[model samples]
Target: MSSQNADVVLVHGAWADGSGWAKVIAPLAAEGFSVTAAPLPLTSFADDVAALERALERKTGPVVLVGHAYAGAVIAAVRSEKVKALVYVAALAPDEGETVADVFYRGEPHPQAPKLEPDSHGLIYLPPDAFPTAFAQNAKADALAVLAASQRPISPASITVPVGRPLWKDRPAWYLIAEEDRMIRVDNQRYMATRMKAEQRSIPADHMPMVTSPAAIVDIIRDAAAAI
Candidate 1:
């Protein structure tokens, strides 16, 4: 499928919403690719997958599914054949029977990584400071402020569940490693990308490259879409 004929579905990770992909959407749309930033409720693994499916149902052609941060597992859980490619951006990719948390915590946490815990409502939110310190360390003051203000708390149930065989195993997969990320370490990203045998690209970006390095994010997504 050509780029213009493909649909690009972008899924955000924990503590973020569809708006986090603001920088990427316009550029891809301008390239004649129909792009949709699928909103994940961050409620549960199943719920996020269902939400992604609903978004996919609204698309008419082949899809290049992209996931950022924690949404990696969410995108992988989807079984849609329309998803012709998978692009993981500083994202996780747990193998069959492995939980999102299992891969997320595979190695030592970054020194600046936030100490996350469930609040009284059983949801985990990134600390305000974590946005500038770890989540998107390369983001500017204004962007960081907006990110912290618009943050969404993710439910523990979302990461604690075991994922089935990932779609990356069956599709052409690409991984963009955030070399400067403090949330998910570079070693872990390399390990996951290698394990999945994905075409890997590395850049000096923090966890949220879609915000800090939108052009790089757009380049990879464009490549993924073009490959389809």
Candidate 2:
């Protein structure tokens, strides 16, 4: 049941890349898990999912897929049998016929939530200032700066595209609810977790807990691996 024998793939949400999981990676590796931070283009839902598929191709055997934020939707899109379990770290798990946006824009927006829209290039990027404030208030100053500078711009289609029956419906899953998340409302996270019937744990951290609370994420991933 040790994760050391399993392939643990980490998927990051929008406006960020594999580096978002930087804080969690070494720790997971230290514990003997074969970990990978999947790279997503964030161009569109299909594109993101395809990128994840490529990452999966690099691994072998049963895999525990861990997704955060936008990567949640990406993880559910995979049809690979190697994926043994899913870990939703404040992720959005849309059901059949539901778009990521449908779950995202559901409840009243957090008062301080940044207004989002696609730019002239048809991609959406989180504002620089929103990094330290709404996204990861608990992150260190240098970490926040790196995040703001290197963030990716996601296509608006990434949200509007509807999904089919997610793999989570047929696979074992875990949900980590970020209670203080400002990007994706906590209520929305609750609704998704409830509907998916996932094993849930509420953590007192912002959306990017991989940086502020890496141990918690590692613990949850380890637990999920144990069950698998």
**Among these predicted structures, which one has the highest TM-score?**
1
For model 2, the superposed segments whose C-alpha errors exceed 4 Å read 1-3
Please provide, for model 1 over 112-184, each residue's C-alpha lDDT reduced to its tens digit, 9 standing for 90 to 100. Answer: 9999999999889998889889998889999998899999999999999999999998999999999999999
Per residue, candidate 2 scores C-alpha lDDT tens digits across 1-228 of 334757899998888888889889998888888889988888888888898999999888689999999889889999888999999999999999999998888889998889998889888889888988899988989989888887988898788999988999999999999999999989999999999999999999998999888888998999998887
lDDT of the candidates, in the order given = 0.92, 0.89
Off by over 4 Å in 1: 1-3
Residue 172 error, candidate 1, Å: 0.5
lDDT of 1: 0.92
Spell out the clash pairs found in candidate 1: none
After superposition of all CA atoms, the RMSD between model 1 and the true structure is 1.4
